[model samples]
Target: METRKSYFFVGVGGSGMMPLAMILAGRGDQVAGSDRALDSGALPAKFADLTAKSVALFPQDGSGISSADQIVVASAAVEATVPDIVAAEAVGAARLSRAELLSQLFNAGVLPIGVAGTSGKSTVTGMIGWILHACGRDPTVMNGAVMKNFVAPQAPFASALVGQGEAFVSEVDESDGSIALYHPKIAVLNNVSLDHKSLEELRALFGTFAGRAVTTVVNVGDAESAALAMSLPRDRLVTFAIDASADLRAENLLPEPFAIGFDLVKGGERHKVRLSVPGRHNVSNALAALGAVRAAGVPLAEAITAIAGFVGLKRRFELVGEAGGVAVIDDFGHNPDKIAATLETLHAFPGRLLVLFQPHGYGPLKVMRRELVAMFAERLAAGDVLVLPDPVYQGGTVNREVTSADIVAEIAATGAQAAHIADRAGAAAHLVALARPGDRIVVMGARDDTLSLLAGDMLGQLS
Candidate 1:
């Protein structure tokens, strides 16, 4: 009898790797992996979905990799010192980075739509996957977030969706320059901005991504994306924007705190669309999703109809429960631009905005500390609150000088109510204690997925 292929993911509970693991396991492969997060049960969420599927989760150990045929999957965060790497090497198993594995595996499939941008990549990826699934495309998506639209009470965070169709969709990350790896048949790049690298670096990576794909979806409101669109070959580009003149344009817009309702114009016809997901940025996300679906050969009308029902991903403006009439929201907005956008969206709603913004890492704070301070100063309304927990670091090189107190002092200079709580759990308690009816308490952070858990705990406490 032929030996079954064994797949072992080193950091299996990771947001990216978990979905990928689920997809492989759904394909009848012998999928098992190890994660310190799961071993310690520090993240019950990280392994919950896989466990429901009967995908065994093991501790980080050499025992998990006893054969040379085992295919090892790792993320950028996985270190050389991980026991699984040692085990895989001892058995001569093929080691692959999550990006390398995804790029190779995803590119081999049909209708791989790669969504890339400095921001909104994950959102657009989920949006495209949602629209496709709603329109009966049965898209198999690999995302970095738990898409709330796919989640059930049973499967609260359905990250990877196993579908019958050939469309294998995923968000492409340019932070590690892994965007170059996959040649998707359809590519949607929301916008180019400085996040991890310089503008020149972003342009080069995004520019190459546009050129390599069979058809590229570019956002024109952002000049960097426009420049990329201008560079694309005649048969390879489609443009979308809310305020810009493009093939896919959202017109007659009414932006609400709960949803942005607009008419999407495509192929000279206007189709009414309403996005349940809040934010003006989601308008751009919607445009990107529609553009990619069009590239996927879905009818403009069908895609628009399907897109109206997307509820958004978890922690992307997730409403954790209204306790004592105070609305607590959890959002993944670590970067300066994302933080600014989320605040701006929440500010539009009729309520007092209290933002508990946590930095995901010390390195990010050091790199973006100034911009983060400036953003809070600029967008925070009067009566708005800003809370900071120290940046989260999991054994990485980070500047010691950067701290939450540093940001608190800077935001205070702008006359905004900012404070550094130092501890996330304490920060949550502080926010909840201050909560009142008619106020929106937003917990914002990234990298450490536990922020969502913290948000839930805050909500549970409040209720």
Candidate 2:
């Protein structure tokens, strides 16, 4: 398998797929792929970077799969109907799911560290990667989001780092049951909640994930993760928490406008650690990182100090720009839990929020409509406004009964100011008109890459 030289990715522009493609290319593999966004020129910068790394780009047509020896890698979202799949079959190319390829690379020789959770997986994975790098571990890290610390002039899209060391760190997803494919030396479960699947399904997936690890690190503050800890042997399980007793505990919490400080306690030693990234949730993520790094044999104090220099991942409450004294923020907060966390962090500061939220997809919106409505109603202050565009449509038939209008109505009934604008352009206009000097205009959603561009446009208009 190490002699395999060529890889063709189906959705090369996707957040998850991009990092893997880059990693393989960095390792001197012949990487080539296609995506709808690439063909439409939606992400020219990303495509250009990939091309510079010697990874060829192609349209979704069958031309990319040239030889029978080339491996075709595709995400679970890519159906068999895609032209790339047809081409691969025609060429007799070996096919593999994205997760299958990742697991094969992860389980090979390297000491794999897998971060898994309903949320915070990307952030925690980036943090662990950064810590390991800072400690001179020279680990190869694959994350879904761009890690700002690793960004360089040549590598603007710094989502993956290819290192010649014994450590390999990556975030494993449980959404499509891919978490079962990984066998990590140290597995970190940040938190467990309802997002992609039912609670029962998540429990089984996450439980198996933790059980397979050599040393499992869990969050005691999260009810589900904490419950899973009970099944693991004490010698094999490590626990971290903010409010509950655990092997690693964070206390003396201090939350600033865009940063947070906390005291990390482990093994009767307390280290004062501060993060440039804001929110109490991040502190929990930091604790999880610390636990995982410590499990990997890094000294507690060294790992804590390395974490102090950690720059957070993009789109996790990323500040786009401040124009006319109004700040425009872009966030990947589509699910109810993630949305609530972002809102809570923003509310900790003084400014009123003018939130323009696009539901990630029609199906997720329908699945979590009531929870989403309740989150908006409970979190938004009286003067704060919540605007909604239609759920992001990606060419699938879904139940349209629980639309953005339904969510807005439910939120408005709870005495919060809310409106549904049908589309992003109208929502942007409404948000611009309502913006004030001290207000924050937050463009929040997921799945759609255009949300960041939309946020930038809003900032320009405000200016």
Q: What are the models' TM-scores?
A: 0.95, 0.97
Give, for candidate 1, the lowest lDDT window spanning 10 residues.
1-10
lDDT of 1 by residue, 270-383 (tens): 778889988889999999988898888888788887888888888888887788888888888888778888888887768888788878777667767777888889988898
What digit string (tens of lDDT, one per residue) describes model 2 on residues 286-393? 998988988899998899889999979888889999999999999988888888899899988888899999998777787788788888888898689999999887
Model 2 misplaced stretches (Cα beyond 4 Å): 396-401
Question: Where does candidate 1 stray beyond 4 Å?
Answer: 1-4
Residue range with the least summed lDDT across 10 consecutive positions in model 2: 393-402
Tell me how candidate 1 scores on lDDT.
0.84
lDDT of 1 at 208: 83
Clash pairs detected, candidate 2: none
Computed on alpha carbons, the lDDT of every model, listed in order, comes to 0.84, 0.89
RMSD of each: 2.1, 1.4
Q: Candidate 2 local accuracy as lDDT?
A: 0.89
Looking at model 1, residue 414 earns an lDDT score of 88
**Model 2, 237: alpha-carbon shift in Å?**
1.2
